[model samples]
Target chain A: MSEAKTSANPLFLREEELRQGIELLFFAYRDFTSEADAMLAKHKFGRAHHRVIYFVGRHPRISVSDLLDILAITKQSLSRVLSQLVTDGFIIQHRGPRDGRQRLLELTEKGVEMERQLTEAQRRRFARAYREAGAEAVEGFRKVMLGIVDDPARERFAQSRRDGGRDGGRERDQ
Target chain B: MSEAKTSANPLFLREEELRQGIELLFFAYRDFTSEADAMLAKHKFGRAHHRVIYFVGRHPRISVSDLLDILAITKQSLSRVLSQLVTDGFIIQHRGPRDGRQRLLELTEKGVEMERQLTEAQRRRFARAYREAGAEAVEGFRKVMLGIVDDPARERFAQSRRDGGRDGGRERDQ
Candidate 1:
């Protein structure tokens, strides 16, 4: 039996092994979302609402137009979630200083707290994963995730990094 | 500047680092779903339908209750997707020999083809990521993902593994 296994090309990627990787992605993604979904449910919010809060929290002065680009969702679809968030006092929207038609969004104190709570749960999971996986694996995971982004979105993502906000950390000497 | 940075323990986990990981998960999950969503959109099917088809395809003789358990969705919600898949001839249901009330599901030829197409996109993504990361990171990714699953679902996951479905790659004696 050992010889039979050894006879196969151990280095080669098999179709079956590729299929297992696909199933792992499916199952792993589901597990990742389940925790966040439960937390959102308790707040009478959905995943759409969580996405808005998350991005707004990430970029304090992000405009709705920019948010639409980030989310890749229709304005009409985002409108419902955004309006609720603003109405609920979780997000405060102000007219853009230069672009009157654009609405700038920021989280309120309440919003920040909620965002922190929501993210804390996720962060704990990720931190544990990172610690267990170690630094190299975390780096690899980040690269893999970055590679998965679509070409156009990749450009936007890079631009987001370049246009540093208050939240952006100071440059670390490499 | 260095003194200020050194005031805090650099080796310890920080709020900023934790938040960065949170953002990465949000963005990564979004990118992961986008490929599958585009394909499902072409069929006028949503993620819900895709989930049903995927789990059934992965476990050919999966029961309705078992699927609901795996999906962690309400039966009513799953019924809508399952009914559609069945009506469209993408899935076929059979009565369990041991239990008449239990309905076991399997993909039709059409369903199998559709599942293959949907999963291929994801598989290609994982394949590239795995190869880039190498074996250790892939193993770490799997372990971390399994750890993230909540207690109850973790038990279901373990049971599913024992059942030796496609999700569970048979152990090869090496």
Candidate 2:
């Protein structure tokens, strides 16, 4: 029972109202990634590489198939990007302990540092926004984001937070 | 002010907490675009095209230079994308009335229809999320997004709403 619920207009789903939300999402996401993107450009890498490094950092021994599922990119696309990462030494593949044929992905020390740097650039925005909005607004923000993402199953960090506590709030993508 | 302000932990800036925010942003943004991305694939258009259409739709007579500034892309990149949109008949170019050489961009009728479809796919998620979160949460969500975006000067929709009422609530990058 929010005050906004009782006092706010319920008919905010009109096309115009919805358009504003769309614009906010566009600007927010664009600006959000721009910082990390600049850092990536220095390495002659792009978003594809940033994503591979990020997910590998998050999942630590993530299988190629699993990564393809999460990234929703084609194997050919991933192969091109993955090969570059391997050649450049940002990522290394390991044979699955149980399945010798499987290639599991993990980040190298250099890869980890890149991931940390990228995360740090983007994290500053979230940290500032969350603090400025305060806890209630942050809760509302996450709730709306959860709905927008439409993948509660994928947001394992949120799930983990609910089940317990203190797990470096990063998404596991597992 | 709010209950979460008092009830929630004040010290959430720890690295783990910050990292979770990063993860949520990654998943939320990725899923947010994936739906529209599917629609884009059907038309052989990518995110770059979607952005051009969306912005041109938002600002009907947006000039090329203004667009370049808003998109933060190189002239070479915008030229490739813009020419395609014009050739494909999704957009039309006009010479500025006052400035003979100024290239003004506007979406053609076909472009408008395409823009609507793309926005429709994305709007569904926001509609559901805003409704489920209630008005208060929606307010909170907007506040947080405002901070994350850090472009109050650009989000003229929120400003216009503050000045009065009903404006179809779309951002004007001008």
Candidate 3:
């Protein structure tokens, strides 16, 4: 770890900075999810539910396997949360058109409303941060975070970005 | 939400950018904790256990209430995780010097070793991201993340940075 410091590299490889980075991620992520958590609690939903709603809202007609791959949770675990969403009328499942056996998930109208509310709270924070940090800082922030994502998933993330806002979920991997 | 767009301010206020920010956080945080979660599972522990060990490691002699406040978890929820840590000899609670009734928590030698291993994994990822993104980007990343943290905690975070790398947990709020 100290090797980077010993070399003539312009970068300062201080352990202190590394630790601060870790703490920033911890506190920032905690505060980021907090508001959504409070609102989810009112509906008796957990963070897991929020993830499902957000993803389904982003990529409509997302297959169960794809969601499992994205969330990286067991089918058994997802079954309980997904079932609750379906029963509560926030999520609906449709049989894949090309493959009848596959179950593709989408948010109901109510689910869209819920997703909008939760997302609005988060966007407010991000918007404020972006406005304060300036465009250059926002770009730097995105570059650093994008660098942190796992290699394989980076492409999928970029694809989602290109797909743009709520309505465009065209990249069906069914 | 589009009100910001129609404003005379120079900020772009694009919804696409805001959505990308949300996804970046989700993917980045998920990948950030993946290594720790795997390591914790080997010991039959979870993220909650990791948080207990992390805070106790960072703030040696941290009081119970302070830990509870930082974690924002109920006393009941914290009790289960704390008991497991103590039982496993990862953390030891000492009587506060000024107030014997108050329990101050710190990591045992075994706990320190575990915390080091966990933190090293995270540090490596952060270091790589920092190096790739350059110093300016690193500063920008920190600025934006700091902006996201709630106001009160931000002061404590900065104080911890000034204290420089662990061992200075002297600000007792008992």
Q: What TM-score would candidate 2 get against the native?
A: 0.79
Between prediction 2 and prediction 3, which has the larger TM-score? 3
Q: Which residue runs of candidate 2 sit more than 4 Å off their true CA positions?
A: A1-13, A152-158, A162-174, B1-13, B150-158, B162-174
Q: Which is superior by lDDT, 2 or 3?
A: 3
As for candidate 3, its interface RMSD to one decimal place is 3.8
lDDT of 3 by residue, A55-122 (tens): 99877888998888878889999999999999999999999999998988999999999999988889
Clashing pairs in 3: none
Between prediction 1 and prediction 2, the one with superior lDDT is 2
B1-174 per-residue lDDT for model 1 (tens digits): 244343254533255555555555556667777788999999989988887888788678778877887788899999998899999999999988777887889999999999988877777777777777677766655555555556554543454422333445322212
Q: What is the interface RMSD of each candidate, in Å?
A: 4.5, 4.6, 3.8
Just chain B of model 2: what TM-score? Answer: 0.81
- Provide fnat values for all models in the order shown: 0.38, 0.72, 0.69
How accurate locally is residue A12 in candidate 3, as Cα lDDT from 0 to 100? 40
* Clashes by residue pair, model 1: none
Error of 1 at A153 (Å): 4.0
Candidate 1 residue lDDT tens string, A76-171: 999999999999999999887776776789999999998888777777777777777677766555555555556654454453432333334321
Better of 1 and 2 by DockQ: 2
Per-residue lDDT of B55-105 in model 2, one digit per residue for the tens? 888778888987777677899999998899999999999988888788888
lDDT of each: 0.70, 0.76, 0.83
**Distance from true position, residue B154, model 2, in Å?**
4.4
